[model samples]
Target: MIYLPLLISITEVIIVTVPVLLTVAFVTVAERKTMASMQRRLGPNIVGYYGLMQAFADALKLLLKEYVSPTQANLVLFFLGPVITLIFSLLGFSVIPYGPGLAIWDFDLGILYMLAVSSLSTYGILLAGWSANSKYAFLGSLRSTAQLISYELILSSAILLVVLLSGSLSLTVNTEAQKAIWYIVPLLPIFIIFFIGSIAETNRAPFDLAEAAVIFVFFFLAEYASIVLICILTSILFLAGYLLNFTFIVSFIKETEPYLYAILVDSKHETILSDPIIEGMVYGLTLGLKTCIMIFVFIWARASFPRIRYDQLMSFCWTILLPLVIAFIILLPCVLFSFEIISSNIHLL
Candidate 1:
């Protein structure tokens, strides 16, 4: 029985791990394809259909390449850095629900789980920077850590709005709270802050993504992974997770229309599923749509914007956004109180 349980656990892990590995690859292709369309050029046409296999090819070559460590660097930590980073990247996904029946673990503290796991990725970079003993790598790591830490507060503050409204730390609960209407409707400003904060966390703009090119593969992989994960995290926090409805200002999709193919939503536009297999697949796709769109915005921002002075990033986050979110937090209750959003709570406060 113990062996059987172990087998089942391994199977579950394989099921979750395969998709994440695949997603990391395809997001790169998607980023390239999107940027190419924006630039009016052919992105990747040779590998598979319109170059779908390009990511796979790139991954294979990267995997097969020789990994050379710096002679003066800490050998154990040098390799360990990337390992730690990749491990944390995969770890966070376990808490994210694909649908009602999916996810490896549906912990009640999912949001906290995500935040804690996400923050650890920085340690991996720091390890790599120190292990490599390169000045550029170390500086890049320091910038990465400082920038990510600074932005995480904004992320948390913005997310705290959702936590307050939802009354739960779990992403699943926060998502359910948005079933009737996404928090984005009432929390547009906070939503925007979350988006910008996410971008900053990934070290995309106002920060130097190119500066760490010397660290090359590991740092780069972690960077890309962080971007995509941030997108998914945003999809859960602001938009509804696999809800099949969005409150964004405008969209090509219909209000009731399913974002995924018919596999997920019935003809009548109902999203709840009676069939287990189809429910899981459809929910996965529905959630994928939101994550994909956000990832596109992330790639687009990278392509369109020029890097600003790093000091400006700190100034904007500290001087501008920090105060802004604090004021918003204070202002939210007052507006709610005046409008009768919180009657008993208002009096108690």
Candidate 2:
């Protein structure tokens, strides 16, 4: 029995970890290709058929590179920074349900668990900045930290709307609640608010401070890892995951191309995905497809938008997202009551 449970856990870890790592890989390639397309150029066609192997090549390069720690730097925290970053960034995915019984950890406090894990990455960034013993690194980390804190508040406030509407903390259950009608229809404004907050939370373009390319790439992976997680979460929360109530993921992908490109361009979303096995696959595919669209938006924004001033960054988060989220949170109950959609009162704390 003990051996069986251990083996099952190992299997589950493989199930969740491998696919996510692979998704992050292709996300890098998509960023490049999308950026190239934006500039009216081709991207990564030489490296293995449209640069499919580019991400893998980049990974191998990073792995082979020597660790060059500064002599004056605090070695302990400096080294620990990446470890902490990679861990917490991947850790948040544990609670995100991918499909029917697809979650690694389907606990009642799943949303809270993700929130807590997500917040912990800040320390990793802080340590990376402070331990480097470089003035540039310190200033960059300060700006990153400020962006994290301000946007995280907006993220949480937006999540509070989900809690009120769904009346459950588990993402799996919340997804089920949206089977009839996706939350995006009723709460489109809040959805947009959360998404914009997600963009800032992941420190994509505009909010991102331009820094040295070498070290910034390391920090980029860490932040972008969380971006991968949040993108998936956003799909589940607003896009209705596998239920396919609204083929928004595939629909959004159609924007960048005639059909859904990148991840799930496997032609298009078929409406007849009714079989359980097929439903699960479609569900998982839809989630991945939606997340691909989200990631593309991340890269698209980076390519198109200019970096904003720090003061403007802080002001937008507080003045715009905060008040809007608050208004929505207050208005949500009235909407639910009027629509007669109120469910069990789950703890919003």
Candidate 3:
């Protein structure tokens, strides 16, 4: 029985992880394509149909290359750093739902778990940079540590607002609360802040100082994995997770012309859509589309904006974003009280 449960858990992990791994591979291709389009240039087109297989080709090339370590570097920590980073980056996916009840581990404290896991990725980065024994790598790690720590405050604050509204720390509950309307509608400002914080947390442009000293392919893969995970998280927290409501359109069509509605919406449509397996597939697909859109935004921002100076990046976080986040933290409760819209589910801290 114990072995049975362990086997089931392993299966669940495989289901969630394989898709994420494939998506991370293609996200690199998408990044190239998006940047090329933005710059009005051609992207990779020779590897496969419109460069579809370019990511795999690149991965192969990376695998074939011999790793050359620095003479003075700590061999153990140097190798261990990227492994640690990749492990923690992948760990966040255990809590993130792809559809209803579709996760490796869906616990009540999932949000907290995600936050804690994400914070640990920085330690791997710090270790890798320090172990490299290169000044550039060490400096990059220091900047990343400072940046991640600073922006995490903003990220947590923004999530706290969502938690307040949803009255649960679980991402599953967070998604359910937005079934009628996404949190984005009411919390647009907070969503914007959250999105920015996510970008920074992922070490993406214009805050990509962390990648300046990349030493291993594992580091690269780990970063991309983090990007996809963060994008999915953004979609779940802001958009309703896989819950689309087209009832208004259907109702309007039915009211206008009953015959047309009967022709357009038939038993087959209902049967296919209502089937549990099909419903789960559709929900999973919807979530994938949402995640892809967020990933594109990350690429778009990278291509559109220049990397900010390290000092400017820190200043923006501490001086501007931190203060704004603090103000919202104080002001949100007051607004909630004034409107009597405070969630009954919120536990007093």
Candidate 4:
């Protein structure tokens, strides 16, 4: 019986990870295709079936590509940079509930865990830039440090709005609170702010100061990896993960029945199983669809926007995003209080 549950957990991880990895892989292809169409050119038509295999070909190329290191550079830190970034990026998946009760770990501090892990990716980027022993890499690292630090503040402030409204740090609870109306509707401003902040956080175009090569071909693989992580985190946070309906609740009940039965009896276990799995699946699908849509939007922004200058990027984060986020934080509580007062007076009417 214990083995069964363990197997299920492993299966869940594999199922979720495979699709997400495929999505990340194809997202690159889709971006190229979109950019090609925008420029009125055919993109990757020679590969296989509308260039669907191009991503695989690129992966093969990267795998075979020789990795050279500066002789004077610290080999340990240089190699550790990509490792750390990749690990941190994967860490976000721990707290992101993909379907009803589908997450590998569902800590109550899910939101905080996400923030902490996401922040670590920046350190990896900085380390890579400094250890490369090249001026371009060093400058790129400096730009990334400034950009991530400035935007993270705005992103955290926006996330705090959701935490405040939800009254819980658990991603599951956050999604539950959005059952009737997504926080996006009530907190549209914050949603927009978070969306843009995400773009900056991931160093996407219009905020991609870290990879401003003269030919625009300078690829920051570590930075791009971090961006994919941010995109997934965004979907998990605002888009509502697998708990779109009461599916998470139903799944929870089903999964915990053994422990409940061990304590109570067969009657209680049967009572829990009365909840239908079909309902849970429907809700889980709803949440999954929302997350996919959010991911698509991230891709859309990348396809549509142009990269901004480093100074302009800083100004946007500090002068624009910071002020707006601060305003929302200050105003949200007041608005909630006014709603309470108005509700009380309506009863007197």
lDDT of 1 by residue, 22-66 (tens): 778888898888889999988998999889999989978988999
Runs in model 2 deviating more than 4 A are 210-218, 245-275, 337-340, 346-349
- Give the candidate order by descending TM-score: 3, 2, 1, 4
lDDT tens digits, residues 1-349, model 2?
7699999988998888888788788888888888888999998888788789999899888888887878899999987876787789888888878787888888888888888887888777788888989988888788878788888888888888887888988889888988888888988898899888888877677776523311645576776687799888998888886567546655776686663354444445444344577678877887888888877877877898898888898889888788888888788888887887777564324
Instruction: List clashing residue pairs in candidate 4.
Output: 99-242, 206-307
Return the lDDT, model 4, position 188: 82
lDDT per residue, candidate 3, 1-349, as tens digits? Answer: 7699989889989887898899889999999998999999999999999999999999999999987999999999999999999999999999987778988788899999999999998899899999999998898888888999999999999999888888899989899889788999988999888999998999898998888757578888998999999988899889987776757756887899888788767776553455788778888888888988999999998988999998999899999888888898899888998998888876364
Instruction: Please report how far candidate 4 places residue 272 from its true position, in Å.
Output: 20
Local distance difference test values of all predictions, in order:
0.78, 0.80, 0.88, 0.71
Pick by lDDT: which candidate is best? Answer: 3
lDDT of 1 at 56: 81
lDDT of 2 at 144: 78
Of 2 and 3, the candidate ahead on lDDT is: 3
Off by over 4 Å in 1: 205-214, 245-273, 337-349
Per-residue lDDT tens digits for candidate 4, residues 181-258, read 667778888888998998888777777765562111113444445555666566556665444434455457567775
Q: What count of clashes does model 2 give?
A: 0
Task: Sort every candidate by lDDT, greatest first.
Answer: 3, 2, 1, 4
